[model samples]
Target: MTSADRLWPFLCPSHPDHDDQSLNPVAADAPSLVNLECSRVLVCVAENDLLKERGWLYYQELGRRGWIGVVEIQETQGEDHGFHLYALGNEKAQDMIKRLAAFFNREMPPLL
Candidate 1:
C-alpha cells in the first residue's frame, strides 16, 4: 500500500466501515495552514524516507506562503522511514528525541 493509504486511518476521515474521528485533527482545511497558532514548526524526515522530499517541499511552501515562525528540519542521514520507531537505541534516534524535546520546551515568539 502507498504512504497515503497507510496514513489515511490516522490523518483522514475514516473509511466507509469505520467511524473513528478521535485521531483526526478535525481540520478540514490543511493545505492552508494560515490559521495555525504555533510560532515554530519542526519537520523531521529520514534521508531515504518516502516523504523526505515532500517534507522539504512543505517547509518551502510554508515559507512561500509567508509563515512568520521559524521552520526547521532534522534530516537523519542514512535512515529510512520510521527508523526512529524501530531503532530506538540508535544515536540518530536519541538525537532526534532530544531535539524534539528541546523544540517542545522552547518559547515561541510572536508571529511576524
Candidate 2:
C-alpha cells in the first residue's frame, strides 16, 4: 500500500468544525482554489518515481475542479526522480529543458 493509502487520515485530516488541516497542502486548499485569472499550470512527473502517481493525481484533481486556467502533465518514461538534474547531458534531460522553455514562452490565451 502507498503511504497515502496507509496514512489517509493524517494526510487528509478531518476537523470537527470541518476546517481542513490536511497534511497535503493541495488537499487543504482544493476546495477554495482560485486566482486563475490567466494562469496556467504544468506538472512534470518521472515515470519510475515512487511519487509519480501522486503527481498525476494532483494534476487530474486540479483539472477536474476547473480551478486552474489550464493544467498539463508530462511524463518522462523510464526515468526516476531527479534524473534530469543528475543526468544533465542526457536526451531526456535536454528534452525536459526544451519543454520547460516552450511552456514558459507560450502566450496565454485571452480570458473569456
Instruction: Write model 1 residue lDDT over 24-49, tens digit each, in one string.
Output: 22223344555557788898899888
Candidate models: Cα lDDT each:
0.71, 0.71
TM-score of 2: 0.70
Per-candidate TM-score against the hidden true structure: 0.70, 0.70
* Span of ten consecutive residues with least summed lDDT in model 2: 16-25
Question: What is the Cα-based lDDT of residue 14 in candidate 1?
Answer: 42
lDDT of 2: 0.71
Regions more than 4 Å wrong, model 1: 1-30
Model 1 Cα shift for residue 86 (angstroms): 1.0
